[model samples]
Target: MDLASEEDKEITIGAFNGWDESYAAAYNTKYALEQDGFTVAVESFDAGPAFTAVSQGDIDFIMDGWLPVTHEDYIQQFGDDMEAQGCWYIDAKNTIAVNEDSPAQSMADLADMADEYGSTIYGIEAGAGLTRMMQDNMIPTYGLEDWDFKISSTPAMLAQLASSTDAGENIVVTLWRPHWAYDAFPVRDLEDPEGAMGAGEVVYNFSYAGFTEDHPQVSQLLKNLVISDEDLASMENIMFSDDHYGGEDPDGAVAEWVEENDSFVSDWKAGALAG
Candidate 1:
């Protein structure tokens, strides 16, 4: 009889920065897979770098692709190279939030207050898909050609926002729903006159092409995965409930949720063994 190949098998999952909202779901999935006896590795990369790495197969998967919009090109190029696991969050929306007292109530309002607001828009890292959308579409479409946009990473941008909001100064920063900021701050989303940013999007997971074949049971669990706004909100709430609530404990919360939803978990596990 021929011996099977000696090479060991392991799954590597990729994620954006450690602070991304999807980090929790990714950890939860990792925990679930490990429970089934598979050796798994978790890797972190910048959002843009993560897409490139996954495309080149340097990473096994990224569980945080916001869909039908952001990262559209990345999905098109690398999607065929991987298997889409499942939907994570269905309505992840991006917003342009200004300080609560800012006179700019909408994109149109920004035009009138461009001078007072410094003729500049605060954005996350320039490479972020949303930042590109803001520059390539929101700016031009809204006719803010002369307006300047400052691109900084999330922590940096949020820091600027905190300073401005605390002083009740005029400020605008790219924001998103289902993010920790929504739970921690009272900023408002500016109305879109041209609708350039598009509506909320569906977030999903992706794995290497043969992941399902190599780990059918684990793939099944991923396929049955579905998270709603309430689910995400609960996680965010825990992170902000108190100074002692800790932060971003997605895996722990997921495990707790699963145990409390045994019937639902069983349904997901059902038929998975046949694969």
Candidate 2:
């Protein structure tokens, strides 16, 4: 448990591509571990590959696994090979959102106003659980079979959102809570009367099976971690800003956040390392 120990000094964290919360969690943990004299590496991959890497012990852990819903299949497949560190954020949900001024107030309304939205519903990566839900449930449940469900990266969807909003045009996109987009864009989630998107979920950290045994102190640190929505949103607002987007200086953003919230950082570290 010695902070200066040479053993278990290095760690690797896996993240989903273009997920802002994933980056926020990974980089925040990296900074914290570094403060304890541990070296950490943050790597990005699609959800499926990221889960595979962590389960097979190719990486140490991941800080962003939405559970009991969004990633139920991944956990059912890989849970035996990994340990749930804990839930760090809660009440998370996948959503289909539109600008505040849009006339559609619910999912049911989308079908009738499909033409106004250009008959398209922008979405993130095809492999994302949100994408699966939309394809298998939301679309069919809401009678949107004839509408176009555009599949692309998260950044692409965000770009489309930005463009549409700027032009004062109605647009619909699949999104989620605890996301920076909610703050960055003038959007609101459409009410899902059918509840096809599922209920609120918890975001958890999962490490390789033997990670806790190999690094008990670090494991304890992770177990003690919890981030509030406001704090997480604030950090992400900075991390995903124009200056820090596209893998530019995210570490610096974390550093700035840490500096601004020294007491919170100190309390978290002390609670974990305390006997």
Residue 262 C-alpha lDDT in model 2: 78
User: Against the true structure, what is each candidate's TM-score?
Assistant: 0.67, 0.78
lDDT of 1 by residue, 129-236 (tens): 789889878888878888888888977787887778778788888987676565455577888877887888888788777876765656666777775555555555
User: What is every candidate's alpha-carbon RMSD to the true fold?
Assistant: 6.6, 4.0
Clashes of 1: 0
Model 1 / residue 180 / CA error / Å: 1.9
Q: On residues 181-274, what C-alpha lDDT tens digit does candidate 2 reach at each position?
A: 7767789999999999989889999999988888887887788788876678768877986634545788998998888877766777666422
Worst 10 residues of 2 by lDDT: 266-275
Colliding residue pairs in candidate 2: none
- Candidate 2's C-alpha runs over 4 A off are 1-7, 45-58, 69-78, 111-120, 125-129, 145-153, 241-243, 260-263, 270-275
Number of backbone-clashing residue pairs for each candidate, in the order shown: 0, 0
Off by over 4 Å in 1: 1-11, 17-19, 34-39, 46-60, 99-105, 113-120, 126-129, 143-148, 167-170, 198-200, 230-275
| Whole-model lDDT per candidate | 0.71, 0.86
User: Distance (Å) between predicted and true CA of 245, model 1?
Assistant: 9.4
Global CA lDDT computed for model 1: 0.71
